[model samples]
Each structure stands twice: as structure tokens, then as C-alpha cells.
Target: MGYDVDCDKMKDECGVFGIWALGQSEEAANFTYLGLHALQHRGQESAGIVSTDGETLYVHRAMGLVADIFDAGVLAKLKGGAAVGHVRYSTTGGSHVKNAQPLAVQYAGGPIAVAHNGNLVNAEALRSELEAAGSIFTASTDTEVVVHLLARAHPAAAPGTVEHLVGSVRQALGRVSGAYSMLFLTPKAIVGARDPMGFRPLVLGRLKGNWVLASETTALDLIEAEYVREVEPGELVVLDASGLRSERLFPDRPPAPRLGRCVFEHIYFARPDSVLFGRSVYEVRQAFGTQLAKEHPVEADVVIPVPDSGVPAAIGFAETAGIPFAMGLVRSHYIGRTFIEPQQSIRHFGVKLKLNAVRGLLKGKRVVVVDDSVVRGTTSRKIVKMIRAAGATEVHLRISSPPTAWPCYYGIDTPTRQELIASTHSTAEIATYVTADSLGYLSLDGLYAAIGAERTGFCDACFSGQYLLEFPRRQNHAPLRLVGG
Candidate 1:
């Protein structure tokens, strides 16, 4: 589902989960599995888990959904008291089993595993440097570069001590740059760290007497863990037998004027039930609808959401505009990755496979369709046509978020700027292309008001073209075949 050919939604980044359960090795794998299951919406291309007993590490990873990859038989084999897990969508690597994480490896110091949830802007440069110095890489993922750095870092303490592991991790991360919320599982502890800019989310929680770390609060909720606090940007937290302790990753650098938290999390990426960046996602989305309604008031018979993501916003829009809210379109949750297509006879069949218009609800109505975003505009155009065919007299499209004019380099997978319809066309031109009676996107200022936060603390580069960090220009490199395992 991560790489749906017919879907125009922005591709999600990866999700990371880690747990430190002292004297509970038997339950660690099970708990990690449930955590990953809750985070499945973030990524579905691959899943993995790496667990550690006091003396040994066990790993299992595959290219598939989390539920499909792990079973009773598989989880039973991953014996450990602490563990780290990952669900990946490959923002910087090829989609192969080798790229699936909790990338486990044996180095000079000992065994270590890491689960990463963000992209590294300097990965290619670091990889080139490592390769030049005689390091061999087994996977194409940016995560593998971190592992190599850890292997080469010189620790001042003894090889297997907690100090040794923490020192090594700090050294490794210091050399790399960009948006990363990572979990490292050493035999001695489970460690979590976020980038200095806070471009992604990583939270701390507790279950019974055990410690937990996840990319979002929803994963903690699913595991029945009590929500604790976020692992702050530029902070490194270590959880061992003695419990949790924290350290600053970049103490020397002056504090940034603003945190670079990804704004898309509140607008689209996160589940409605989740809390992200100290705000309730559902409430924020409803506020988005309210603000959108205030910005673009339309005279319509009914306001309908464009299925799952738009439901909250649409409800708020309807309430604010004094229009009735209805489910004019229904989405099919059971759509698979592949299906047979009628040869050259069906148009917009892909959209039809996933959504169906409610003829009775839309018939003879001036319907307003609300959606989270419009990516390439192909899906939106098809959906508008479908609504028209279902007897809607007038269709007005309202977007909950501002136009996505630029690609995301932090973690998300998005089309190039040239491919985005809003990058070149005005709102009126886009409305014409999509064949809607009217189109309105929430203003950038309205979005900030809805979130009840200052614009200084967020990375709205996709909307404002202001990136927190400078990324290297894209370069053509020869294909790298699988090297050594």
C-alpha cells in the first residue's frame, strides 16, 4: 500500500519503536509487534524487529506488511528483554528486503541494531566517504551509513559498557546531519535520539515498570502504555536496568530560533486518533475545517468529506457553514495492491476500485467535497467526475491544507516540484483542470491559526518553500548492485 500506483496521496516516512523490559524477555517481542501494528499506517512496504537477550541478539525482517510478516512462530524466535522495530516506506533507498530495518550488525565492539524513522540529508556524502575508506555496505538505505559510522567510532570506555555504547552512538550521529528520530538497541540498553531541528517525532512512555519509545503517541496507546514525554530535539535518552537518563546531543550550538517540526504531521500524515507535537490530531484537523470554512464560505446544499482523512475537516466545515454534513462518498478499506483491469474500456476504474459515490446523498445537490490535499490532481479530477456522474448539480472542492508546491527532503516521499499541479497553475487553473465548480485551499495563515501555534516552530517547506536545511542537488550515480550480506 505504500507505493500505490494509482494513488496520489503523499507517501509516508518510516516508523520506529523500541522497548526496554527488564526481566521480561518473553514479552518484549510481543509488545514490539503490537507497537509496530499500531504504526502500520506510517509505512507498509517492509517491517522488522531486532531483540536482545543479555548476551545475544535475534532478528527477523521482511518486505511486507507488519501483520503479514510477523506471526506466533516468528515472534517466538526473537527472544530478548529489550527490542527495536521498524516499518519502512523507503524514502532514500530501494524497496528490497536488504533495506528493511532495525538494521542489525556485528561490529568490533559487539552487536547493535538500529531502527530509523527519518531521512539523512548527508547520506550520499557519508556513504561515499565510508566506501572510499574500505567500508562495504550491504543495504542501499541511508540507515546503513549510520551503522558503519558506529562501527568505526572510537569509544573511550571499555568495549561492552553502557558508556562505550553511548559514546559510540554520539560520535556516529555527530558526523551525520538531517532529520532523524532513531532508536538504537545495544545489549546493555535501548537508546533514542532526535535531530537537532526536531524534524520528526519520538516519544517516551512506560508500561508496568518497563520503558518504551515510539514515533508517535498512538503506538503507546495501542500497547496500553502510559504516555510520558517527547524525546526532545537535540536530546538523547538511554533506558537501561537503572531506568531512563537523558543527554543533549548538541550542547555547544546556540538554540535554534525555532524548532523545525514537520507541519504535515498535523495536516495529513498522522492518524486522527494520535497526538503529535503536543496537539490532539483530531481536534487540530477539525480546527482546520473550521478555519477553511471561514476562509472559503460556499453556498452548498450539503458538505461531504472525500472519505477517511477528510471526515473531521468536513464535519467542522459543515457545522461552521450551517450546512448538513453527510457521507456522500464511501471508501473501500479492503482494496488490495493489485487487481485486474478491463482492457482500455474503463476510465477512472482505479479510483472507482477504492471509492463509490452515494447516489442518493449526492443527487441534485450542490455538494462540497473536502480533502486533505491535492497531489498530482489526477485523483481529484477523477473524483470530481465521479461525483458529477452521481448527479451532483454543483461540486465545490475545498482543501484542508495549503497547496504542496515543493517536495519534502526530510522524510516524506513526494513528486518533484514540476509534477505538482499547484507549483505552476493558479487556483482557478487547477479548478478548471479538476473540473470542479470551484476550488479553495486553506491559507497558510489560517493553517497556523488552526494549529494554535506560531509559524516559527514548524517546517512548512512543502507549503512555503522554506527548508530548514540545505540539501545537495540530485546527482546521477550508477546502479549499486547488492554487495555483501
Candidate 2:
């Protein structure tokens, strides 16, 4: 069989990169590529890079993974001192080549390449306003809206002035609302900013005398960069020859939200190796498993994880329950996220094509399978069926997260309420629906212990229906209130 992009689609968040050459143009692309690789978990739809020398800007964007999109030949063609890159998964816009990012725009002044990590709740409204004023769009992504806003926001100044560039970002921020951790690259320097709420992550690092900015600390770790610190919420930071400068964009925008951080960053989105908001992602997931063990103890001969995403939690479950942990399902690592089948109707059939049950390990065993979370129920049901077909005596399902009942508006590609399986089914109902012997989910409180209380905070609207921000009243659905589990 030929290679097919794995179509087992999950909620994907985009990754962003920023680089200040510090007179070293040769290594910027390599550093950004390694950084993006560490952040590959953040997105898989496409990868793009934009770089600027003191004189000119270079851009290269294509659909696929970072390795697929740029090689030495491609990177050589992109020459610049300052650079910014993006790996994108379009949650708000239709996925297309035009939607691939580090979107470069040519304004009346010099060009600016922009890469963004979060969602804008007011995108549609903002797009409408721009369209009303005759702004033409090349991509459907909300990121393009920022460029349009910047085109208007750009102050009239003499060419090559930093004032004009910084002013544009400040102006765009005034007009847009919602979550964002963005990087802007001009010909001379790289600028990074986070929304006042800091719903997404962005960090500053230094390596070989150059400064770097990325969506996750793991990215810095991969490139052997020394992490300086997280870019403070509502702070705008500029990196250039003079060095790093910071300013608060929203000094009066209320007290720092106690719960403004993105919750899914801990759950299914981030790489387990990542350290988010002070807690290790793997440690937090293991806590989820331990919590699951305490809340819903189960009887089984072996505790097996679905692999990769489920390993940490399964390890926690096995340790807590004093059961042997085995590898139950093994995944083929060759496939890309865009793995397509012949048609949409049979698209999900690709999951089986990517993963297989180890009969020798699972045969005749009462197996407890742990996974991160179940979105639509299709994958879980199929996995259970596979275990049964492999001669498993009983399949007990353990989920490391509470039921996901709401669609994520900040960035994750969760489905609407009608399409979410847990939103429509109870825990017992889900167990029956997936054909598992029994099932249990970790509680919200359990997550705190898993990730630790002092290190993490989340916006768990999907589990408990409490949006950290006021719910916007939609014309299609009534205004939502904070609902408890």
C-alpha cells in the first residue's frame, strides 16, 4: 500500500516562531526548524517560514510537516537575518494552502511576516468590518485579518522607522479581541506579544548570542537555547541589536485573570515533554491517570495505554492500581496528519490503518485501556472492537479527562455540541455505546493533583461549561452561562 496521510483528525493548535539573527543568519532557519519540530504537536496541517535580512524579506510556505515543507535547498533560498515561522491547523478557517502561515503582507512600507497562536473570538465581526471597507483577502484565516488591521493601523512615518512597525501592532491590538500569542518580523527586528488574558503560551530564549521566541519551552530546549522567561501577559517585547524591550499593552485591563490560561494545553494538545506554566506535561498526565485510578478503580489483568498520548497516564494507572503495564496498541509513525483516504465517508477507517493491536500481549487479558480523551467516539469504539477481535477477555475503558461537552472557541478544533459524543451521552451510556465492559473519567479536581496545584490553571469550559471570558451571544445559539459538571 502507498503512504496515506493519517486521517485520525484531532483538535490541533498552531505553533509560532520568532528569531532575531544577532548577526548570525546561517543558523536561524535551522534553529526555527528544530523549534517547530518540538512544537509539531501544536500543529500538523502545514508549515511556513519568513525571514528578513537588513535589506529584504524572504518567505516559504507549503502544506505539510516542517521537514516536508523545507529542506536545505529550500532554506538556502530563504536568506535573512530575522525570521518568523508557523505550523498551522486551521480551526476557524477552511484548511488550504492559502491558509498556511507566517502570513507575509506588503504594506505601503516594508513587508511584515506574522505568525499567531490562538483564536480571535471577534474574527467574523472584524473581518466583516474590513470587508465593508474594501479589504481583499488571499486567505480565509483570521491571521489575514491582522494584516488588514495592520495595513490601516500602520502609522504614516518615514520608511525604515521602528515607530511605524511597533505602532501597527499596537493599533491592530486595539481593534482585535480574544486570545493571541503572536510574532511579527520586520526587516530589522522581531517583535512578540501575548494577549492581556495570556490564553496561550509564548516564551523568550537565547542561544549562541541570538534571541528566540516560541509557543512552548520544549521548542527552546530542542535548540539548546537558554529559556529566559515567559513573555508576561499583556506585554509586548521587541528583540533587536539594542536588546530586548518590554511594555504592557493593557495596563488598565483589570487584574490578571486567575483562570485565563488555556486548559486544553495540558490535556490533549501539548507534547507530553513540554513544561507548561511551571508543571511538566507528562507529570500532569500521570496525575490524571492516578486520579482516574482513585475515582474509578477497576479490575483488570493488565493496564495498557493506547500508546504515545496515553502512555504517561497509563503508567500512573498501573502504578496506582499495582497492575502490570503493557503496550496494547502500537502506532505507525510514518503517516502525516493530512493522510486522506479515497473519500470522506470512509475517512475515519484510516485509524485502524495507523494503529494495530498486539494480539500476543492482549489475548485473554482483562485489559484496562487508557486514552487522553474521546472526542466523537469513533476512534474509541473502533479501538475497543480491535481489542475484542484480538481475543481480549474484557475491555475496561479509562479516560484521563472529564467528558468534553463544549466546542473550544480559543483555538482547539473541537466539534460543536451536537457532534460531541460526551455532550450527548452519559458515562455509562458512552461505555455501552463504545462496547466497553466499564468506563470512568477523571474529575476536574483530579487534574490539579496530576499537574500540581501551584503550577497550573485552566479554562475548563469544555468539561464544566465555564468560559473564562463572557460567552458571546450567537445568533444561532442562546447566550451560554457557566454550567457545572
Candidate 3:
């Protein structure tokens, strides 16, 4: 029902965080801003910051990008030895300033601000229960559920106690289900926690004596912070007077089942320059294209990528296929905001303003078009039609990753079952629907090899329809496949 013009329909969410100790003299907000800018590709909706001077907690949050929301004056206002910041993309919240992150709540102890990076599967039911119990909600965001739970878990009388805060968070997390990587800001410390599955990323780093936790290591690199290590799945870290301390929150759950790092992190979600799970995102994506070519061979005069996200994989595909590659389509950097435009009519029209076919490159070319993944056929179909209109002799679509058949309950914004193009149709049907001359998708094995991660270790739930974490039962819209993208 939302803007359905784009053929491939996955919109990724990004979470970024930065923090400084009470004694540190550095401007924590500015460093956080730079880190968020580096991670901007993950989310573009809202930004917030909470800083503490050891005695008082200061906060500023709004619905806009980091660049648009925070300036020198705003950063100066958030004066503190320590701070936590968030850049958000709403997978389950309304796109308004009220729903913006660093959701803060005051108690007798002090103020606690939270920034969350993933979605909670049980949010709807939880919100209903809280609302019925007299919880007045300010924002219709799942994140506020945490605050409600925390308030109930920790009594107001408990003051200046990290143990009580941790206990409250643990109790709150015990009742919720699904992926989350969150940063908690108290006047005394900044804390980080990851869900048991580690469905989203949270990494730890250090700059001088200051500590930082972010959704990706790339953020640390941007601010010249030294990468300490990834905050382990189910691990809770507190940066306080005693420096960094970690505790196991969900000890009963066994170690990650092959460490289900989200495969899409490299395919489409993460920045190309970012490193994840000790591997280069750029290198992995290129490998994905190379593996895809080996698995799905096709004859073509030239190979072309779908631009931006698909460029790395497309290059790999071209090299592996021994075909020449060209920048066949150029993206318009001046495209208007898709979420802010008054209606879908404007957003759909905005797509054209963002992308244009290169007639000179497409003319008479037998092009093998490479893309990261296909969601709904809308965007892919439009792109194929555009290439044909641009005079390409034939357009063969090759996807580096496998088709997305299931909705992601973690963080990525994938449509429901009925809206997925691949869920209801076979590859051939999808090809015809998208108007591509021929179509090929990377096999699950090929995709595995592309990223070079252990097959037993990564989470391909979106592609395979298999879930590692226990989730609330939903109707099985499609049958599970042994092989996935």
C-alpha cells in the first residue's frame, strides 16, 4: 500500500552510537556526528543525542538526519563528559519527531535514555498490555516499550545503582522477543546490550581513554577510535567509573548457532568501506558477484550493475564472467526525500529523478544486469523497461544474492508475505513479470561462498525461511527451502 513503484523493495535500517567518559575533554557529540555520517547509509530518518556531565543528563532528539539535526550550537548545548547518540530508521514506528530515538525517561534515581537499532517481534502485544495498565505513551515506537518495562522493573527509590539498572533491563528483555542492539545512557554511564541471537550488530571501541559502542566498526574508524572487539551476542557492557565491564545476560541460551550474522549486512545494508565480523563488506559483496557468475553463467556482451549497492557485486560478476563492465545507469543525487513527499505519486515520480538510463552505454548492448537482491518486482521491472527504452538489445537480469521470500522481523524493512514478488511466483514468472529478457539468481551455495563465511554460521532467514530464534507463530505464507540466496 505504501509506495510500490520500486521493483526491489528492501529498505535497510542503520543504528549508530558514540560515547565519552566523564573526565575526557573531547567533544563527544561531534565525534558521534561523524560516526553517524559514516553510517548514514543505514538510516536516514532521525537522530538523537543524550549527554551527561556526571551530575545532569542533557538530551536533544528530532526526526531528521544527523547532518540536519545537530550543529555546533546544538552539540555545545549537549555538554557532558559522556554521551550516547542514535541515527534511526523506522521499521515499526511512525516517522515523526515524537518517535525519534534516545527515548528518555526520568526516575527518582536519574534519567535513562535509550537508543535501539533492531525490531521487537512482540512489540504490538506488549504495547497493548502496557496501555491497558495505565502507561501513557508519548511515542508509538517499540522502543518506548523498553522504558515502560524498565520503569516497572526498577523502583523509583533505587538511585545511582548500575546493578539495579542492569536488573531492570534484564527483566524487561526477558519478556520481549526478537532482535535488538541497544545503547542505554544514564547520567553516570553508557551501556550496550545485544539480543541473544545477535541479529543486529553492536561493536565496542576506544578513543584515548574514552569508550564507544556502535552498530558497526566503520563508525569507530570514522572517529579514529580503536576497535576493541564486537560486543558478543547476549553480552551486556557498561562503560562507567570502573571502565568497561561485561556480563552475560542470557546465559542459558547456548552460543550462537554458527554465529548467525545477518548475510545482508554485506550484500546491501552496510557501507562498502565497513568491516563486519572481521571481514571487509566490500570484498565480501564482490565475492558474492564472482560466486554468482560461476553458479549462474550467462552469455552477454556487457555486464552492468544496478548502481550504488549493486556496483561491487556487479564488478565481481563481470570479472568472473570474463565480460566487460560499464556504468550503464547513473543515479541522480538530487532525488527528493521519498518519505517526506506528500504522497506516493510524488515518491514514485521521485525515482526517475534519482535514476536515468545512459543511452550511449545501453545502445545495442546485450547487457547482463546485476543487482544485490530483488524484493517486489516493481523497481526491477521499471529498471528493465528503462534499459529497453534506452535501446539496449537485450537485458538479462542477474541477482548477486538470492530472492527475498520472507519478511524480516529483526530490522530490515521487508514487506509482508503477500507483497513479496518471489513468494508468490517462480523465478520464470518473476522474470516475465519484471520484463527481463532472461533472469538468474545466485544459488544459496553460491551466496554462501561469496561471503566466505561458514555456512552453518550466518543467518539467511529472509532467503531460506528458516529462523534460529523462537518466534511467535505466523501463518506460513511460503514453504521453506533448503537452499536460499
Candidate 4:
């Protein structure tokens, strides 16, 4: 069962999946269930699935993990030919069951189920316009904005029935702005689309005769699906019994289309086992560590990681620096990695339950402790203090990415700018606050080098102040209502 846990860290927003096939509605729901299970790591707060057998749509959603939401009894009830699933960590709307997605709606065109992976930048503007037009909203999610837009749209051209419906959706899609990797499921077909800047990851795959779409390739791997290719930026694909069809949403292709792919996907969000932006997340993380080691070589007797999240970079750092790598800090895998300690007195209690320093390994040693990123610095401080208590003669902290100095507005749940340690403090100050003898972070250029991709085509908003899209001049700094925080 999915349980709620609080910790000082970046939270992933959501995972989306949709499957459609010829004569496979009975099995489509099962495939989607497994796919959501594979992507459970992305979001653990709530999960839901919507399936359709061409004439009717079946929906089941709840505030819990996918494993807890469904079973043989539930799956048997969801007999359908096409299915779409979502696992969510609230970003825009609060963690209410009403906000849970594969958000099904009935309109003039009939049943539509939508699943989304990224936030909308201009959701407030769009929501206001919809409300003025007499639209009644049930949830305060940016996704429902699209539904309202669909209400006002007319089929631009209708040579066929399915094409007419797709045209109507295309018309509504043209009116929006911001990062979105969306799945639109109808009785007749399943559709997937990515934003023009492509700020989130979405991939296409196939299982037997079934066509599958998901936020990460790992979802496909779980069901033994063969990966097709990434859904390109500004591209919308429609899958039905006739098969897959695609159209570019923003067809004004530039000489070199710049896809503002989220760099954080490689830095932390994506599963190491998944391939994103055409690179293995594991390999990229290792590269980030290798690059960090190049930038910050330390004289230490041993190298250790902060635990599970820090292990990959730690491995890379150890290999690159030729330092001995050991589990100096061990994580309690049995404990919910997401443990909660709401009381101020128990703040340290939560981190302790998750990780503990190994006194035997750290005794009399100069340690190089590598971690992925330091967000609030509170947890990192507690960790460093624990390592000191474990008898480490010295602890030099190393990070695999540039310090996050800004907040992310796309699908990632992060502390506000004021809460970000790096946003208001210098590296020296951060080191002092964390109580580390010394500290080092990978350079921005080094991070780009690790990805082996040109930096110009990526979103580094959280690291650099430059935003890929234009922000409103009068910023409220309020959390987006359409997309989860």
C-alpha cells in the first residue's frame, strides 16, 4: 500500500501510461497496471487507471500506491480494450482524490480520459478564461483547463469521424502554453503528445500487437514491451485499430528545433534503469560523478555515499578518483524510504531511520561523502553530523550537480526559492551550514559534458536563472494550480 512520508528532498510529480491494441481490451488494463507498478518510484501518493472497451469507460482511482489500489477483483471489473494509468505526487492541486488522474470527463464528443506528466505555465490565465466562458471545474488542475478548452473548440476539418475528434483536440492543444507530456484516451483511440519544448520525458513502445506510451522506458520494460522511439517535441501521436498516426502540434520547425529537455531527469528524477532523452539514467549519473571528481579531487582514505540516491554518483566518483568505495553509510531498505516525522523534535529521527553511518568502515578514515544534490541542507547537515559521530577523521562532501539556485515550475515538487539553501547562500556558506570540512559541486559545463548533449537545448532553470519559457512579469510565486507543485 502506498503510504505518505515526508523528507527533505525533491519530489517527482507523476507518471502516466496508456495502452491500446486490437482485441486486447481485456488485457490492456493488466498491462497498464504493471506499467504503473514499474513507475511507482516516480509518485507514491496516489494511483488510478481508466479503461475503455469502445462503448464504455471504466475508472478506478484512490490515494495510495498502485499495488494497493487494484487487484484481481478490481482488474476483472476493468474490462476494456484500451487503458491509461497515472501515479501522482501532488503538485498543482492538493492531494485530493478528486485530483487523481486519467481524469475522465464526458463532453459533447463523449468519453475522454487524460493523464499528464508536467505543469502548465499559464494555467491561471487559461482557467480564468474557461471560468468566464461558463465552465464549471471540479478539480483545480491545469489538466482540466484542456478539458474546458475542448468544450469551446470546433472540429476544424472532418473528413472522417475519428479524424474529426482528433481535429477538435488539436484545435484545443494549439491554445495552451507550458510543459506537458499528455495522454488523451477516447473510446475510439489513444493519443499521446509532448510540449513544444519537451520539458518532460515520454516514450513510445509496443507489447505484442499493443502500442504503449509512458513517462519512462522502464515502464515498458516491466511488461516486456519493445521501445519504439521518443515522442518528439511538439509531436502528437494517435493510436487506434488502424494503427499509429502522428502530427506536429507546432509545425513551425526552426533550423534546429530546441527541445528544452529537463536536465534534472538525468541528475535525479529518472530511474537509473530507464533510458531517457536517449541516454541511460544510470550512465549519466555515473558520468556526473566522474565529472564532479574531475572538478573536485579530494585527498581522502575512503569514499562513501549518502545511501541509495547517492550510490551511483558515489560509484562513479570512486572509480574516477581511484578511491576505495565502501558502504560507509547504510540505508534501511525495510523502512519506508519515505519516513515521516512531523514533529520538530523528530526531524532528525526520520533521517536516522532511513540511513545510519557504519562506525567500523568510517573509523579513523578521511571520507569523501558524495550525494546527488543538497536541497534544503537540513538533511545533509544531519547526515554529516552522523558521519562525524561515526568516527570519521574528516568528511569532505561532494555533490554531482551544480547547486540548485532556483525553483522548478515543471512537474517537479520542490521547496520555494526562499527555502532553497543554494538560492540564497554561497557554496562556502552551504558547506559551513552543513558542517562539512570541505565541499565541491560539479560545474554547469561539466554537467552538460556528462550528458554529452549541448547545453543550449536543455532546461537548467533550477540550476541557472534562465528560464526556457517566459514568466509572467508580475509573479505571485504561488504554486501552479493546474499542475501539481
Q: Largest lDDT belongs to which candidate?
A: 1
Tens-digit lDDT track of model 3 for 146-191? 8898888863435668777777778788889877898888877777
* TM-score for each candidate, following the candidate numbering: 0.96, 0.93, 0.92, 0.94
Q: For residues 1-485, what per-residue lDDT tens digits would candidate 2 score against the true structure? A: 33333222356789998789747666677778888888888888899988877777788999888888889998887786678899988887887899999998778657888999988888888899899999998888888899999888757666556767777788888788778999998886788989876889988999877889999888999988898888877899989878788988655466454646776778777888878877788888888898899998988999999878899999999999999999889888875544546766775567677789999989999999999888888778889999999999999999998888877788777777777888779999999989999999888777766766732355777777677665356654424665311
Q: What is the lDDT of residue 384 in candidate 4?
A: 92
Q: Report model 4's TM-score to 2 decimal places.
A: 0.94
Report lDDT (CA) for all predictions: 0.90, 0.82, 0.81, 0.85
Rank by lDDT, highest first: 1, 4, 2, 3
lDDT of 1 at 442: 98
Tens-digit lDDT track for model 1 on 75-99? 9999978899999998999989999
TM-score of 1: 0.96
Name the regions of candidate 2 deviating beyond 4 angstroms. Answer: 1-9, 154-159, 338-349, 454-456, 475-478, 482-485
Location of the lowest summed lDDT over 10 successive residues in candidate 4: 476-485
lDDT of 4 by residue, 379-428 (tens): 88988999999999899999999998778877888888888899789999
For model 3, the superposed segments whose C-alpha errors exceed 4 Å read 1-7, 154-158, 252-258, 339-349, 473-485
lDDT at position 152, candidate 4: 72
Which pairs clash (backbone N, Cα, C closer than 3 Å) in model 3?
6-378, 6-379, 7-378, 7-379, 7-380, 14-42, 258-457, 332-354
